[model samples]
Target: MTVKRHDGRKADEIRPMTAKVGVVPNADGSAMFSFGKTVAIAAVYGPRHLHPQFMQNPSTGILRVNYDLLSFSVAERKKPGPSRRSKEISKVTEWALAPAVNLEEFPNTVVDVEIYILQADASTRVAGINAAAMALAHAGIPMKTLVSAVAAGKLDKELIVDVDKEEEDFREGEGATDFPAAKLSGRDEFSLLQLDGKIQPELVPKALEMISSACEKVYEVQKKALKDFIENPEGGNGK
Candidate 1:
């Protein structure tokens, strides 16, 4: 196992995290979350009636997520607006938070979540998920529990809690395995799991254990941000 990370974090340690709510006053609800240098902002609009009458769900309200990585967010700037990658991640994010939300009470309606990466080092999608989860709650959506997420995997021969850009680019030893996962904070339930690299089957359990633990820490931060916003809606930017 590698003894030290390039940024000096222990294998199981995460970079400092920052979370806040009410970042966008115009939106019904909004939040921002960052993992070290990677930052994401999310805004929630609606519970409004579904348009296009044919598409409305009588059984429950539907969630529509639009995720985007700003053109200047990375060194290799992407084209502006939604791309295939953003669309796919948006769908995965919807699936991640859907289970925690109780939408039956608002059938035939829609909840739109807009997420943008203001800056990205690595783990942008997971950061977007974290921000979006808080925005949903701030919008007054009833939820069973908050959802938290992280990208945890193997960095060479070592296990890591949260993968950063340097670790993501590692091309030595066993290489890197980027596994982004999400879970409901108050329960032992996984909401999403996507692996971008290979790993031995025997190591799966250990990786999952690490991911679960990291998410709890993320959840604590998310929970605190929400409570802080409730107590003092005018302010809540924290680390």
Candidate 2:
């Protein structure tokens, strides 16, 4: 059976996307990223000194992340403060991005990444991580490579890449799976792997391959966005 996405995207196609850097003038580095209806803005601040209490290692810089969903971002207004879900996402985002950064470059300082979701359809975490990675590059933080992410899911017995909100809802039903993964660009190492639903063991390999290909595409966009920003600091559309 052929499954048609509501947005008209093919099973293997990602949503229409765009990424822009230097969106927040006050931040050391900032980026606005969008994937279809989901939009995430990220700001990076500091390679500055971390307070003694927050400093965990004396020889390496700390990578701190705060992921927030604005109250008006969803269909129903969300609460103002950080929820348990947001906190967990923040921690995972930090961990996912740390592997791509050279934390030792800043010694005892901290690089803080803050992501705000202005809108959401699905795959908000992936979008947020992408924005954060770009923001880090925009801020001139030393990094091994940009980190890119994508979510692949099983819907109607067919595997799909970059699932939107409607497909995500479908995955919540029986026998469906929503797998979100992230990896550093040009490397086989995975930085994040999360499975939201059950999947046949045999399907894992196929799903990983699908998401990895999607992440590579996203990485290309991220690189272009950062390059445009660097070349045209005054104004660049990030085409």
Candidate 1 structure lDDT: 0.90
lDDT of 1 by residue, 56-146 (tens): 9999999888889999999998999778888899999999989989989999999999999999999998999999999999989999999
lDDT of 2 by residue, 1-239 (tens): 55677778888899988999999988888998888999999999989778766565778889999999999999999999999999999999998999999978678888999999999998899999999999999898999999999988888578889978888887434645678888998899899888888777898899889888999899989989888888898885332
Q: Provide TM-scores for the models.
A: 0.96, 0.94
Off by over 4 Å in 1: 236-239
Best by TM-score: 1
Give the CA lDDT, 0 to 100, for residue 148 in model 1. 96
What lDDT score is found at residue 38 in candidate 2? Answer: 96
Q: Clashes in each model (backbone N, CA, C under 3 Å)?
A: 0, 0
Q: Which ten residues in a row have the lowest lDDT in candidate 2?
A: 169-178
